[model samples]
Target: MEHDYYKEYYELERNHWWFVAREGILSNYIHRLIEQGKLSSKDLKILNVGCGPGRSSEYLSKFGKVTSIEYDEFCCEFASKKTGLEIINGSITELPFEDNSFDLVCAFDVVEHVEDDQLAVKELKRVTKKGAFVLITVPAFMDLWSHHDVINHHFKRYKIKEVNLLFDTINDGNKVFDTYFNSLLFLPIYFFRKVSNFLKLGQKRKGSGSDFEAFKPGVLNRILYKIMYFESSVINRKIRFPFGVSILYNWKKF
Candidate 1:
């Protein structure tokens, strides 16, 4: 990620439809776990892997103490100043922590950035305490790949089955929740990306842009947020979606 991109992210992450809605969805899941007595909201040792820009660490702070790590030194500095929390500089494939360190581990949209995603998953599981939880989100479907992925330096997008296999290979955890989110906008986003790719839109600029750059705050943003928030409400009711723009999964370490 470039410095310019990080600057844009710091500005938009607070209210962008994609960031805000995804946070809402994940918060719902965490709240559900608390409600079910599966998790406690106080005194938890939480590890936020790949804590880009630090908003996630700030948000996760509500549940308990949050220790954040980011691969980029710039992101570490940017996030620490923004949130006033000390952000550790580190990599997902080689987390600098002892085994069974945290009660909750979050790696939202982080694994896709790693070339050795399996090693990344292993590291996530390694630092998690036995009986603790790990939550992850990743872009779904290679078919939906676009300039957004390229600009973000993603190694690959994921399918539900691929995610399942990624976790199953470790064999140290049980999957508690798994669902495809952003389902409502999947078709619209799919078509837009497809059409955009067909016309070679933004291909000339390549690394110079991303989907985040397309966001404009207004009625459309609010509407998209509301749509995804409603979808999250449905998901909290234990309804599973077959497919969508992204995948969110929860795993409990054994």
Candidate 2:
């Protein structure tokens, strides 16, 4: 199946709660990276692979120029209109830019859908400047397979060590700086979904399906968002979890 189908699948889910939760987590991570001086406005030129709706690119643009590439044409149009950034319609394996052109490259929630994730990582490394970073996030735990995986066209969720190994194989001179999971509070939600599937409580789930609603702001919603923000601060620092809804990795070329 062409992975572009996965893009269309998620385009329908842009406003769901799952999407909101994802954005919140990404915002928190970027804020930390910016604060830590890992990124700066003085540095220009960034490449955002699988830059759905350009949400992260919008934030990244503040630091410099951002060029986002996405496989889904609909997503590219939506993101171009929404973020007003330079976005190209293309896949990660066939990036439109020249080599060693970007200061930072990001592929958020994108790798799992690729048929050969390691080859895609190699492409990411090829385009990034030496000493620059490639940031990525993907679903974790293959056993947590549910409707979301089927709908999203995820080949499989990742194990940190497995992903590390893949990155190592394709990294060339790059080294993984850190790796951790996100959405700790929502781990239970994933657990429930997985257990429900295992027990056959519902029909077999398929695709990148999520029940999360994004703009349904309420007191509980606000609280949950705050909790996630707090978690981002303490996670991978004070707390180390073996599993969660998503995994984040930051890799740097040496």
Candidate 3:
């Protein structure tokens, strides 16, 4: 049976303010990739690993041919309907594709849920072309664990050094372009949330209705989006963060 909570959250994400804000952040990141000449509409074949409901693929398709791979059959179906792109259903440990077939492979906010993140990274490396970009975003800091992490089945959040270690065994030719944290606003909030959870202070996964209006106040949402856009641009130029809610990384095969 499908996890009802996951499904409901995804449906909410389809039109949620938090979701739109995240998309804007991604757009800024993609723009930077374009500015660096890493993404091109004419030649790049983009793959979005663990693509949820295909929103990222739809955004990325403007730059290249996009194919999204999702493990959930429902997500894949929804993604196909939403983006009109091909959706492959499979595990990250075993990507259903030929080696060196894509120019860009992206997995956003996905690695933490995998039991074997190292194998998952290796699988991603195997499917990309030489010097192809591998972009990933994952929750940062295991210390920030909360009820959300428990409900989401997250094995562990990442530390920069820990993630770097996972890439150590990857082909020597593969180079890390950048690694940095994202969601600056949520840093302190997450710290407190984690602390609260750690203390067992009324810890519970907020149901779908909770936070439904967190972003509904459009003024706040728009302002936050603009701030994040600026922050994202700055970070893309150079990855540096004392801490954050999530991490974004860029790597390329040699």
Candidate 4:
């Protein structure tokens, strides 16, 4: 990301509806794992791969100990200050951890940035304990690609078929359990981005979101959150949506 956009992200993450809704989705998954005895918050050792400013890492801390890795020094510094957790300056393409180092590994919106996503997935599996879960989230659909992707240095957006194919190649023997989310508002967002792309409207025409400002009522924010939260509730019940703005997966290492 451009230098200023990182600042924008840091400032907005705490209050943005998008960020809050994303956390709500992940939080539901974590809590369910606890309920099913698949994960124990107190004993888990977690690796937060490519955590942007460690926001997700900080959230994961409530579930277990979290160690973060990011390739950028700026992100490492910001995340360190925000979470005060150990932040390693590293890349997902080659995580600097020994085999089976963590009980849980999370790579959210991170793989798309890597040049070799397959290798990155392999590293995620390599670092995780056998039968441990790795949660991944990435932007969905190549058709949705625009300057937002270019500005963020994303290599590829994903489709459900291709994403599962990557996992199967390096399966290590576990099945892929996954879903598409950010569903209800996908059409509006898609059209908005399309128009924005056609007009090339962005922060200083840089194809970034930093200069974009949003003002909404507290009620509005809450309503949006609730709508998304309801979709997450559907996800929690183990039903996967057929299409959405993003894709999420939970693959257990074997």
Q: lDDT (CA) for every model shown?
A: 0.89, 0.69, 0.72, 0.81
Over the full model, what C-alpha lDDT does candidate 3 score relative to the true structure? 0.72
Q: lDDT-based ranking, best first?
A: 1, 4, 3, 2
Distance from true position, residue 191, model 2, in Å?
3.5
Weakest 10 consecutive residues of candidate 1 by summed lDDT: 200-209
Candidate 3 off by > 4 Å: 1-3, 10-18, 195-217
Tens-digit lDDT string for candidate 1 (144-226): 99988888899999988898888898569989989999999999999989987787675655435677656579999999889
Q: Candidates sorted by TM-score, descending order?
A: 1, 4, 3, 2
TM-score of each: 0.96, 0.80, 0.85, 0.92
lDDT (tens digit, per residue) of candidate 2 on 1-254? 23444454345435344555566656666666667776664766788898776666766677677887889887677667755777889988878778888888889888898998888888888898877778888888776787656655678898888778877884356554445554556566666776766765444324323434222556766665566556566652535556666787778887
C-alpha lDDT (0 to 100) for residue 192 of candidate 2: 76
Question: Which runs of model 2 end up more than 4 angstroms from their true locations?
Answer: 1-21, 34-36, 174-176, 195-209, 213-216, 235-240
Q: Using TM-score as the measure, which candidate wins?
A: 1
Clashing residue pairs, candidate 4? Answer: none
Candidate 4: residue 157 Cα off by (Å): 0.9
Per-residue lDDT for 92 in model 3?
A: 90
Instruction: Tell me the tens digit of each residue's lDDT in model 3 across 1-254.
Output: 14455566555556565566567667777777788776664767988898876777778777788888888887777657755778889989999899999988889878888999999999888898987778888887776776666656689998777777777784545555545544667765576666767665533435532333335546776665566556666676675666676777778788
RMSD of each: 1.5, 3.9, 3.0, 2.1
lDDT of 4 at 80: 80
